[model samples]
Target: MPARVVVGVVTSDKASKTRRVELNRTVQHAKYGKFV
Candidate 1:
């Protein structure tokens, strides 16, 4: 499989070359089948 590309907001970029990112995704509640 090819590498998956994810786009997200950079929440923190203060720690040298490291960074923190927040990804928004929805998951279906198993039994209820509702997105969460």
Candidate 2:
């Protein structure tokens, strides 16, 4: 297997030598089978 690269958004950056990242993903609903 190969290493996977993930991309996300930086919601905030107000710390000393640190960063805040937000990773989002969609999951299918159990009953409706819809991805949201």
lDDT (tens digit, per residue) of candidate 1 on 1-36: 759777799999998989999999888999999999
Q: Candidate 2 lDDT, tens digit per residue, 1-36?
A: 659777899988999888999999788999999998
Candidate 2 Cα misplacement greater than 4 A, ranges: 27-36
Q: Spell out the clash pairs found in candidate 2.
A: none
Clashing pairs in 1: none
Candidate no. 1 TM-score? 0.61
Model 1 weakest lDDT span, ten residues long: 1-10
Cα error, residue 22 of model 2, in Å, equals 0.4
Q: Please estimate how well model 1 matches the true structure, expressed as its whole-model Cα lDDT.
A: 0.91
